[model samples]
Target: MTTAQRLPASLTPLDTALAAVLRDVAAVTPVELALTEALHCIAAEMAPLRAHPPQDLAVTDGWAMRANDLVGASSYAPLPLTAPPLWVEAGSTMPTGADCVVDAGAVDAAGPIAQVLAEAIPGQGVRRAGSDIAEGRTVMEAGRPVLPRDLLLARAAGLATLRVRRPRLRLINIPGGEATAAFIADAARLAGADVIRSDAPGRDAAAIAAALDASADLIVTIGGSGVGRIDAAVAALSARGEVIAHGIALQPGRTAALGRIGTTPVVALPGAPDHAFAVWWALVLPVLDRLLGRGRRRTQALPLARKIASTVGIAEVTLLARLQGSWRTLAIGDLSLDAITRADAVLIVPGTSEGFAAGTDVDAYILRE
Candidate 1:
């Protein structure tokens, strides 16, 4: 009899397992790199300082003068503005002797001398330095994802580079191209991680041992990690390292393995694109945080719109959708099929359900953008 076809890919079970496992896999990657290169790095703590205007800057093109000069001046009894104040354009530095600036438009220009018709409030027309941002203030807090804007702020604080968590990344199939290593290298580039070239000695105990001896923050294995007879990844790790998880109960991706290579954590993932993609977001990411000494992180909640049938005794990470204000099932297991990321979040059918009906409310685990 022909074998029954199972669904392609999923994230739920793997995400749950990762959540549990990353807690135990502890280490931290501290990196000091230029802000330009701090792509995937996140702020480890709030910046110790904030940026203030280098000096007193102007907000508008106005005349700098003492505030008391315009107190009695009004539209009717316009004060004869004299040489005591200086005429300057917008963005010019505030003169040391001047206390405030009057908007050029606010002055009645009857001749070379401008007269003030309206009462000029003290510091009203000027932007004071240190007002928007105070020095020595904490700007970015720990656990905040480093984004382009955050980097911009860091630069403004007179920082060209920042101390950040070194990005942790693993790509299976790099040496063997079992699944496709170069593709992962490309994706890692998009994710802001520089791909570290790696290889398993020869896909067995001897090979894995030698590679483990090599310097690497993360280990990437391509192919050879499955229940199948030729799968040597599990056997190799069995010699020196224990498998944190053997089979994640998710189809196609069930072969995905998480374990240690010597002291360094290793990820043995399916070579397939969709399976690898799902595991990358659900497992590898959080595990990276653990390895880098970051506090734990979890996916934000998005509502589930549809029910999905999952295998009994197995956890299902259903890939679902939210479209036109309703939740819909997109696919079962493999989301990397060029179809699934269309949805905002993935539906996590807990490991215990057999299947679900339409309109089932389940947890939707979000992914990093």
Candidate 2:
């Protein structure tokens, strides 16, 4: 049977529904970007350049001389210099014919005359060429996100630019009167996508089709994804193309929809601000990462400071706050902006388990820019 025919007029499992949403997603093409502008972008291939120090240099501020010249030298029987010793600073190239550096405190010098009071070994206190980074070494691997330190490494490797992938997203606000559009746009941008937003008055199919016609890599609708009469995002998506899944087994976001319009992927989020944010974080962001060729979000395990109840058959997402060195679930049923602002993490309660009690360990996904 087809995927749509398998729907049971009930909520679908979160993982199963998300898999359908991502099945049709195609990764964006890679493009060359200046190293400075490649931050947060995924690298298309291994860095091609190499970083090799050109010459051997001194690693300490001292006097440069042949090691043989300092043999048998000690404090009781100091060895006087036959000729002036060459002075070298840290990171300075060694003078010709010099094989070692004696610490400044080990040698007593006055003008052209110097006395060596300690033994020296060849190659001591010297940094060899390519010691830090060898030639032909891989600086960065493909599918790795470009970070600030990665850029520095690329520059040090003689690379002026790098090939990266950045997904372009088109956001359509169905029932556009809500104020959650801006928040959605910001979240998309934070996921390393270039976003263009459009508003459709009360689930107008024509407006959504027009936004799809703009030819973005992916299209996202912010509202009108429920069973209510005004919830027409699913119908609009069906009119344009195929609807993959209509209802996910997720609290506060069970009405989420996923589909495709021709070759482009589309995600329909619920109207409530908190529900929209939850669906975006749990479902849409993973698909966006695939299109952008980026890595998955990082998660950490933490103990719950209090009890959190949930239905046995439905997955629930709860806002988390770090209070007094422990994670506490915020009160649900309030979708206000203030609640979101106060949350530092997000906790997901699985559908198979009844719920988590105080001191039970749970995985928390930390929110970051």
- Among these predicted structures, which one has the highest lDDT? 2
Model 2, 252-316: lDDT tens digits are 78888888888788888887888898888778888888998776567767788988888877878
Window of ten residues with lowest summed lDDT in model 1: 1-10
What's each prediction's clash count?
18, 0
Error in Å for residue 72 of model 2:
6.6
Worst 10 residues of 2 by lDDT: 1-10
**Each prediction's Cα RMSD?**
5.2, 4.8
Which tens-of-lDDT digit does each residue in 1-369 have in candidate 1? 212222235433655667656644665555677887876565565456754665676677777777877788877798877764577777787887576778666677768876887676667656677775677775466555567887777776777777666655655452454445665566555544546756765655457555543255666566666554445666566565766676676654677777776566777766666766665655665666565555544444433465566777565556656566555777776565655547556655556777777655555655435
Give the Cα lDDT of each candidate. 0.62, 0.78
